[model samples]
Target: MNKEWFNSRAKINYFDKGYLVICAVLSVIEQQSPLNSTYR
Candidate 1:
């Protein structure tokens, strides 16, 4: 697929990696943080 092609051919961007890491960390916090119930 086109996505696979991009993965093989494109240069990785540090900004893109940082964004994904931030998103993953936020998801873990939302799932397990003590403040989760406070928000809901």
Candidate 2:
């Protein structure tokens, strides 16, 4: 209902989406290289 509340909610949602994306990318990388030696 308030401006501050809406802003915080939007920040939380943005961070949550970013975290999910990072996890998905990490999983894909791991699957591609189980040893994780090539990327490093």
TM-score per model over all chains: 0.53, 0.79
Return the top candidate by lDDT: 2
lDDT of 1 by residue, 1-40 (tens): 9998787655467667888999997787798868666666
What's the residue-level lDDT of 33 in candidate 1?
67
For candidate 2, write residues 1-40 as lDDT tens digits: 5999999999999999999999998888888865566877
| True-structure lDDT of candidate 1 | 0.77
Candidate 1 residue pairs in backbone clash: none
The runs of at least 3 residues in candidate 1 whose Cα sits more than 4 Å from the true structure, single-residue gaps closed, are 1-12, 35-40
lDDT of candidates 1 onward, in order? 0.77, 0.88
Q: Which model scores highest in TM-score?
A: 2
Whole-model lDDT, candidate 2?
A: 0.88
Q: Locate the minimum summed-lDDT window of 10 residues in model 1.
A: 7-16
